[model samples]
Target: MPRAILHLLPLLMLACALPAQARTMSAKIARVTTPVATLEGVEVRLDWPADAATGELRLRAARVDAPDLGYRFRALEWRCPLARDGQGGWRCDGELHADGGKPFRLSIALATGSTDAALSQGKASLALHRSAATPDDTILDLTRVPFAWAQALSAQAWSDGRLTAGTLDGRLAVRTPEQRPLRVDGTLVLADGGLETPDGSIAAAQLGGRFHIDYRKPAGSTLLSLDGELRGGQFLYGTTYVVLPGRPLPFALDAIGRDGQGWMLPSIQWRDGAALQAQGSVAFAPDASLQDVDIDLRSHDLSALGARYLSGWLGIAGLPDLEASGALDARVRLAGGGLSSVDARLHDVAIDAPGKGLAFTGLDGDLRLSGGAPVDSELRWRSGALQGITFGAATLPWRSADGTLRARAPVSVSMLGGQVRFDDLVVQPPAGGNGLRIGFGLALQGLQLGELSQTLGGPAFRGTLDGSIPAARYADDRLDFDGGLSMQVFDGSVDVTALSMERPFGVAPTLSADFALHGLDLMAITEVFDFGSISGRLDGRIDGLRLVDWSPETFDAELHTEPRRGVRQRISQRAVQNISSVGDASFVGSLQARLIGLFDDFGYARIGISCRLSNQVCVMGGLRNPDGNRAGGGFTIVEGAGIPRLDVVGFNRNVDWPTLVERLAAVGSGDVKPVFE
Candidate 1:
């Protein structure tokens, strides 16, 4: 049924019981005048049989137009027969409005100064009474009123949106005093259906809640205090999602609606969730535009905030694998349409990202941030582990202003039996330009390389990693480190420089660097890998090295050994066989082919090899000895230095890089077999 009719029913009833004038005696008609609405084409019949004691009433209306309530109706008719009692009182019985195949019955009793009226349709009913002290005021009482009826009358209140499905049960007391003001006290219960806004500003699913409302027309530009609680449901406002498990999120608010100006909420308080609370004021323009807002939001549990309210945001921060637990108190103030201030303190916080192998324990700190004010924070990391490296407790003091955070002093932390320090560090938040930006200095002191290798399940070597990075910067998802880091292992120094990375913590990241290997003991390296030993001082360099997704992409590399003054350089027979199979080469120079297998090892003057890889092909090279360029101009990878000595020569110059890699893998796994070449 069109609830528009219900909105107009009060006026229709008034037209029936009241007459315009009794001067004419035979009959009189009065047109109802109301600022709430204008009734057009209305006719009322009043008959005064005894001129002053008895009367009958009838009413008819072609249409009613109420702009204030957004109601319009047509073809309205009601008839009631009025009878006078002995005490100058009157009563009427009537049937009105056959809509949706149901007729409404009305009963009214009126005296000179007071009136009581009842209207009933099906199982729903409404009552109205006028106080003797103020005949211009109407008190409305409703019981079990159908929500269908309310919807038809409240179209404008929802911004043209409708309550598509739901069951509502409530009782309300309302008073309207002529044109002075309106007041209401009510309790409303909503069932498990949902509501949607046309503009998507508010929407919900499986919604169930109870609300208590106390309302009064604004005195000035001012409010109606509304209080409510959400018991259960999944709610969506704009784009925020909250899964409510029958929790009470209580709120109180005051809003004033001015005729042409719009609505203003001057005071508001809401327990945002189990862990957060917010206090704010909002003003919306007549067109529903958010004209202004001021809010102070607080949270006491950082753990719950991430899992409950911050999942989506944290995914973009390289912490997608987050599981956190901690006590943290934070205050965020929003004003002037931006985040103006933030103050947070963390206590005994524990955070972990298992996928990234990162964890922090006993983290505590106070961080202060405000517009036009410098920020200061001192965070203490008690103990933790990350990617197999354990860290000893340390305190990092930081300061910032102008959108960049900087370290007030160098911070040192023990790791891998040594210390790592960060100096002159500066960082920008995620909201800054290019996602996030950072610049820093890094220094490593006496880090044990053997422990690191053992922890990584790699070849164990005894040495130390000691280095310094003068500067490093990250922006636009790329990180560039200037200077070099050197590790002394395998009796050698491995120096890396020109190091840089893109998307270091993101998908398919790339790393580029150049490295030089000096004074490496081939014997110790071969012993660690269980490869046949070659006793010599090894030197090598790989330039323009690049890896994409941790797989080698390109490089220019060379490895060679020059004999020490008093050291013997010998290649084991097994090593010779592995190299022959891997390089797809043959023996050359002074060794007897059949007798070469008789010896377990052979002396060599020098050994060298090179691969300039590009476009997935390796241009291989060997030693620069004059004898290396023979009749066919091939270089010798292993030079003979004794009678019946063995020399290994590589003939394939343009080997496929992937094929070479596979062959090397086979050699390392002891699966190589010599291929005649």
Candidate 2:
């Protein structure tokens, strides 16, 4: 139409040849630089040919991909239904994919402006909004997805872990690009899941109820607070074992402390089982290693729990049903899977087992445990007594008194090859008829044969011991041994002899035995002299046999003698003279005639004697006397007169009474030698 319009037509045509424009700029330029490479802007204007100012310009490509445009730009694809906005920047609301990028696929509401922002993907979605001049305040809300999906995301994002929150709401601050902003403050629940670290696993199923946590950004470390009940809960690490119930445990427990490499369990109350309650503290290492533990317990019954927990220490399995009730205060420390120290005190308790297993009243004691040093203790049992004391395999039985019994020091006594230490001990006997009452102080290295024999009956024995035992009493089917005794004997062995008791083995009346001697010297015997001029070895055995009320009835004895060297033994003159009269010896009529001249005395050329000693007289048989009277049968005769006198002795008729007396008297006085020594 006009000449000027015609000239501008080419320029307008050139501009129209390019993409439509909603607003035109005086000059548009794009250039590539070192850091940024390039920047460009575009404007869009659409007209509807059908009617009006509404129109559309669509740009489409099957796929648009860019691996990297620079250090920050990544491979991306964008799809949007473009729409115009009042601002001068482009607007697109659609899905965006950033393949091979730091943060992958994401969705956003896009409106071109001078605002800066970022988004992240995690178990929960996070958004950060910031301006060019200010810091970003973030919002990180837990994902509403199912637990499985959340766990999967957690696994992929963290180290083979599963984490999900029931409800969470918190604020975050993104001060750095490396760590994600973390915000948590809500009632979080974990179920059928677990959190694992280098140390071990903390399973979700083991923890129950609602828990609240307050978390901070940058680190994601949390401040945890809990007030809930757990059932069938168990916490274990190596040698440490702990359990709690979803319902109220037998006792109450409280733990209020900080979390670190080590964990703490503060207080616990146990309701049943073993009839005990305790309050204590426990700790463990980072790798689930055991540390120290301390506790105080009160027991309603101790003896009844023999099978459940006490059998190991006592070396006895089941015991007679018993009821024990008492208060015990105890403290125990453990380290490296072992006990470090333990202290316990018991007060006002009684243990009762059926059939008088053991009866204790008003028993008080202090016990120490662990370490290379000895465990020291002191105990007092008042009004205490023992009935039916048995060696378990022995026939001896006894019962004891009601009095104060005490252990003074660290003294050990062995039974069945097991030892129990006692400090100082004392017991008193019950009243009865002449019952044994004893006060003893002795230390024997071992059992004494003599002492044991005296207690049992006969047959002496010897052994060794090393302790002091007090005397005791026995009376009327009961015996009480007080104090402690120790001794050593018999080639480094210990012997206990002469253990005296009122009534041994609960026998009637009473019994007391003293072991006379054992291991006697056989060679050194026979030192005491004087027995019919006989010098020889003498061995003697004497037994203090049975005593009914304390007197001997039955006895055993034996004696043996052997001749000793260089010892003179003489026979009595009376014996020689009597034998001569009995034998066929005589100095009668011829001997009597010779005596008148020079022979006043008598002598025998050969003297022989033979006489039976049953009856108390000597009878001669054979040659007649000067009176010509013969004696009886089985008679003996003697003859002697002056020197070299012809003497003959004989027996004839049964010797009458007055006949042999006169002949023997003269012979005896003259022939027999005097006895001095």
Superposed on all Cα atoms, the candidates' RMSDs to the truth, in angstroms, are: 7.9, 29.8
TM-scores across all candidates? 0.69, 0.30
lDDT by residue (1-677, candidate 2, tens digit) is: 00111111112222334333443222232322211122222122233244322223322122222111101222333333433345532333334344443332232322332322223345433333333344223233333222443343233223334443332223333232323533333444434333444444443335343344433332312222333333444443322234444454333444332334444556544554444566676665544445667777656556444433343323211232445666566776665445565676777766655433455566667655543344445544444323422112111111222322233333343332223233333433322223223332433343444544444453343443356445544344444455433333332322233344443332232433322223322122111111112222333333433344554433333333323355222222233333435333333455444442343233332222222111323232322233323333332233332444533345543343334445444443454332211
Q: Between which residue pairs do clashes occur in model 1?
A: none
- For each candidate, what is the lDDT? 0.71, 0.36
Report how far residue 294 has shifted in candidate 1, in Å.
7.2
Tens digits of per-residue lDDT for model 1 on 1-677? 33223344444345444553452222223444463455666666666554555555666666766554456666666667767655666777788763224678877777666777777776667777766796444566665555555554345344545565655556555555665654556877766646667876766667676787766653443346778876777755544556665776787888876766767788889785646677888876776555566666666566666655665455555666688777777665544334455677887888887766688999899776555578788889788887777789988787867555778999899999999999898877644224678989999999998888888777687889999999999988899999999998888899999999987766677999999999898889888766687898889999999999878889999989966788779888878887777676688743346777688888888989888888989888888768775556466888877876777888788889899988877777878654433
Model 2, TM vs. native:
0.30
lDDT of 1 at 408: 91
Best by lDDT: 1
